[model samples]
Target: MLIVSQALIPHQDGVTLHPDLFLWDKQLADRKQSWFHAADRTPAEWYASLQGSDVTALLARQIEVMPAATSQCWSVTPYHGQLMRDSIRVYPEGLFPWCSEDAAWLCSTLNPLLAEEGMTLLHSGAALLLSCRDALDAKPLSFAAISGKMLPNRHHEGADGGRLNRLMAEIQMMLHQQQPESRRQRGEVDVSGIWLSNPVAWPQVIIEKKIAVATRNPHLSAIVDGQNATVVISEAERLDQLVKGNVELPKRIVLTGEGYAVLLNRSLLPTFGKPSWSPKRVKSEVELISKLSGWIA
Candidate 1:
């Protein structure tokens, strides 16, 4: 079984640490040698590399699979960003609490207005507002692409990137002008703006094994669909219960957002190490995938 978790380690500096994640980090330290350096810096890129899929394709497929669930063809997610001295910093989903109902109401109100500008809006998740352009000429956009340790200078970017950034600013202005009373009543954090993410296309891949996926990330589920796999969607806290059922355990299991891959057989474990730390540098996605190719053989 393989687990891919987000920020399972304190990959970034200055971000507030969660107590539960800190405990998980301690447990992982015992098996530090087993940890794999993420192929890409951000979780979005890492996930895209893992599935051999791009953000645009994934969002397109999601819209096709669940039309009612989304309102756009291109993938752009929203987030609550805070204005700093010189730039804006996006808040991670862990820092805020949002309800589905509020998200739905917000989207409903914004979609109609946004549609006037050749775009449709959807609430991808509590912390994400998904957007897709009505025209096919524009490239897909993502908030994860722009956000990082430093704030983005949207004024000095390429045409496509700049356009997307401008669109994001426009959406934020719209939300601010019409702040929902429901959100205010609930005393939610003042949503300053939105960040876009998952701006790639879904790839077509075939899995020969009877695989099962246990994750809360919709992208993970979309990747495994039509590949003779079972997807169990549940919150992070209740993931164990969701995966531990009476059915036969799959030969291969992937726990997305957990950050570790487990091979059930004893023989394969040693090829890597004793699950203890090594001074080796992190490997790229291609290298890591090549290393694990033997498992399929």
Candidate 2:
């Protein structure tokens, strides 16, 4: 099984705060094995690597293959954030104890407001950006997606080129105003806003292996879905149980997040260390893809 875990390895300064991950890293090092850094740093980029196709072409195919009942699909992820002066500081989902009830309530209340703008919201925080009356024949005006684990600091760097900036700002205001008093009294961080990433259609990929993907990330799950792989929506911390279950093991298993790759057959234990490719060494996605393709082959 091949496991891809979310940011399990933190930067040097974060080691103290992430003692558990730090210990896991040490265990991998003791075995003289470490995860190889892929061409992309974000989970989205890492997932893109698994697809053996051009991203633009893949998205186009998604539109072609989309069910007639839905006009378009955009990955919308909820996040908790704080307002620091004029800038907003978004926190990872792990920081909050969000339940399914919270997700459903937010979707139910917000979907109607969004529908007026030609979008239908789903329970998984996805929005169907509709363009026509006939769901089966509608042409999508725009396609967009976002990673749930992104930091507000990076989004401020104009990653989305200000496309969803105004939309997010509006959503932030709405969340703040509609935030429940009960939640505030409980000291939970406000479900402040959301971040939008990759605006593309889904791709159609052929599945050849019995692949099992263990992750709670919707973006990762969407990618794996294209490959027709079975998904186990569990947090990274609970991955050991999935890996050691009695069920038949898949040919490959991927854990997406802080980005680790473990060959379960070769390494009986989870290992961590410096990624094989450095930012300085691999400057482009093409180079990273080529390197990873060769290594995995």
Candidate 3:
């Protein structure tokens, strides 16, 4: 079984997070393409090697993934001052053998359930930090994604997908109460960017050039201008480079799926942070619940 550890690190302006909050070693055959074998190695240790040196990191203890049926099967009691406090069931009764397709299916099926409770499903893995009001009041919550991009795995892009935007909204709402603003003042903003996975695969100098393009591009100016904007990058190296500069620290930098990303800018970040549901999952569940003999909504 693959043991994954997630961390929620608070930051000066926001929070930094390791999104893979839920991890259990699955049989290697299940992760055929992602087959990783490091004897007694934790997820953090595995990810650390992939990210390289110079990046400070922390790894939490492994959280067991006990498969079960029912609405309350999977639950979490977050630490005091943490964002997660309720139990969230990613799968319903009789839904076992969660595969990559199932993960995607769950994203769409569960989003509405989450929205009903003022929450949503993100397209990335379960790793995130929340920045409320300011740096003094921030929290990070991590979880495993039902489906999304996995490093060293397949890359799939969706058109008009609003997963990132939805995530931004959830974060904003979580922090709105703590970071209230007066009338006529913008509460917060978010700047997000995507980094090419392979660009960093090149030499450091080549990767540096890409960062130059991001900061210099007209499209990126909005990121710097907003009081709260999240810069989402697909490449980790690019994010590391940005931190080295004096640019304002985002409220949260989230590396989701296969993209190196960040969500920040108080007002904008929340707006864009909202998450989207998975269409495939939702459609299938709706059909199953409608046709299954024992199904009840």
- Which candidate ranks first by TM-score, i.e. highest? 1
Q: lDDT of each structure?
A: 0.44, 0.42, 0.23
Between prediction 2 and prediction 3, the one with superior lDDT is 2
Candidate 2 minimal-lDDT segment of 10 residues: 137-146
Candidate rank order under TM-score: 1, 2, 3
lDDT of 1 by residue, 1-297 (tens): 433333332324322222333333333333324334332223333344445545445434434333342334454444577778987776653343455565666678677766666555554343233544433334433333333333466443344666666766777888777766877788877656555544432233333333344444433444344243343433333344444433443344322232332222223332442333222344444555555444433
TM-score of 3: 0.18
Best by lDDT: 1
lDDT of 3 by residue, 146-230 (tens): 2111211222233312443344345435434432122114332211111111001101121111111122111122112223323
TM-score of 2: 0.55
Model 1 spans > 4 angstroms off: 2-20, 32-49, 64-72, 123-150, 155-157, 200-212, 216-279, 289-297
The per-prediction tally of clashing pairs is 27, 13, 57
Write the number of the candidate with greater TM-score, choosing between 1 and 2. Answer: 1
Clashes of 1: 27
- Weakest 10 consecutive residues of candidate 3 by summed lDDT: 194-203
Q: TM-scores across all candidates?
A: 0.60, 0.55, 0.18
- Candidate 2 Cα lDDT to native: 0.42
